[model samples]
Target: MSKITTLPLGFANALLVRDKGAILVDTGINANKKIYEELFRELDFNPRNINLIVVTHGHADHFANANELKEITGAPVLCHKEAVYALQTAGNSAIVPRNELGKSVFEIIKKNLPRSTKKVNPDIIVDSSFDLHPYGVAGKVVYTPGHTDCSLSIILESGDAIVGDMLVPSFFTGEPCVAYFANNEKALFASLQMVLQQASIFYGGHGGPFTKAEVLDLL
Candidate 1:
C-alpha cells in the first residue's frame, strides 16, 4: 500500500506519496525550505529521502519551490517536455478562463495569473508516459493536458492519481468540477474521463483527494 500525505501550504498543497521511498508532487506558491523541513519532521521523514520530485505542471503554485526542494533532497526533477520553457524561464503557462468565476478570478489576479518561481531545469523531460518504478514506485506520469498544455497526472497502481489543475473545485461552492481555466474543455473532459477510468481517487493541487463518484458527477 502507498501513503499519500497532503503537505499543506498557504493556498495549495504539495503531496508526499510514500512507497518504498517517496515521491513529492508539486511545491506550493513560493514555498520555503523551513516549511518543508518542519513538515518533514512532523511526518518523521528524512528530508533527503525524496527519490523524485514531479512537478504536475508548469504552474507557479505547483513548481515554485521545486528548485529549492531539489537542492535539499537531491532528487531528480521531472516534467513534461511541453513544460520545459516555463520551468527554464521561471515562468508559467497561460490561464485561459473557461467560466464566469474563472473570468472574475482571472481579472483579480490577471497580473499574476501565471506566478513565477526560480528557474529549475528538469532532469527528465518526457512527452509520453513515463514509468515511476525506477524511482521506487509503481506509477506512471501521463500527459493529461487541458488546464494547460503542459498538464500531467501521476497515476499510481494503488488506484490513486495526482492530477494537477485538470480537476478543480469551485471557489464558491468547493464542489468538484472541471477546471476553471482550460485550454480546451473537450480535451480536459477526455483526460478526466481517462483518469477516472483507471484511478479511484483524484488528488489535485488546490483542493482534494476526491472520490471517483464525486468526479464522475462532474462529468
Candidate 2:
C-alpha cells in the first residue's frame, strides 16, 4: 500500500512515501540529518533506494538538507523553477520575505526566524505543472502560487496534496477559523481557489493534513 509519512521539524515538515519504493518529499534543515538517517534506516530503505527528493518550496527548514540527502541517496531533486531560485539565493530575493509587511507582528516574528543553511538548487526544475508518472510516483506538480511565486504543491493520485505553507490549521491561533496570506495576494487567492477545486486532503508545511471540507470552510 502507498503511504505518506510526515517528518515534522518545528514549523516545517518533510514527507516520505512508500510507493514502488521510498520517495522522500522535502528534506528539513541539514542539521536534522541524523534524524532522517534513523528514519530511513528504520524503514528499511537503503539511502540509495530513495528515488527522488522533492523540495515543496524554498524555505531553509524544508530544504536545508536536500543536498546532503542527494549525496547519500543519489536521488534526483525536483521543484518549481521559482522555488529553485529562492533556494539558490536563500531568501536573499524571495518574494515572500519582501512581502510580509501585511502580516501581524507575531506572524512576522515567526517568519523572520533565522534559517539554518545556504541554498542548494534542485537537479530538476519544474517551470509549469507536470505529471510525475515518468518518475514512478503517482502525482503531479500543481503550481499553487501566493505564499511565493515559486510555491507549489504535490497532488497525489489519491487527491492528497502536499502544500507548502499555502494553508495551515485553525488551532494555531486558538481560534475556530484560520488565516491565509501570500507574498502575492492575488496569486495566493487564485491558488487557494485552485487547490479548493482539486485537493481532497491538504497536507501543508505547517500544521495540517486538513480535510478538504475543513480547508474549504477556512476559505
Q: Residue by residue across 1-219, what tens digits does model 2's lDDT show?
A: 356778776656777766666677777553556777887788777778778888777666667767678778888888888776667766522434323233443365565654646667678898779776666678778787777777778888777878877776433452223224456777876887787788687777666678878776766
The residue-by-residue lDDT of candidate 1 on 10-64, one tens digit each, is 6778999889878899887746888788889998899687899998888788888
Which 10-residue window in model 1 sums to the lowest lDDT? 109-118
Q: Residue 37 deviation, candidate 1, in Å? A: 0.7
Clashing pairs for model 1 are: none
lDDT of each: 0.86, 0.69
- Candidate 2 lDDT (Cα, 0 to 1): 0.69
Model 2 residue pairs with clashes: none
Instruction: Tell me the TM-score of model 1.
Output: 0.96
Best by TM-score: 1
TM-score versus the correct structure, for each prediction: 0.96, 0.84
Question: What is residue 11's positional error in candidate 2, in angstroms?
Answer: 2.6
- Point out where model 1 deviates above 4 Å: none
* Number of clashing pairs per prediction, in order: 0, 0
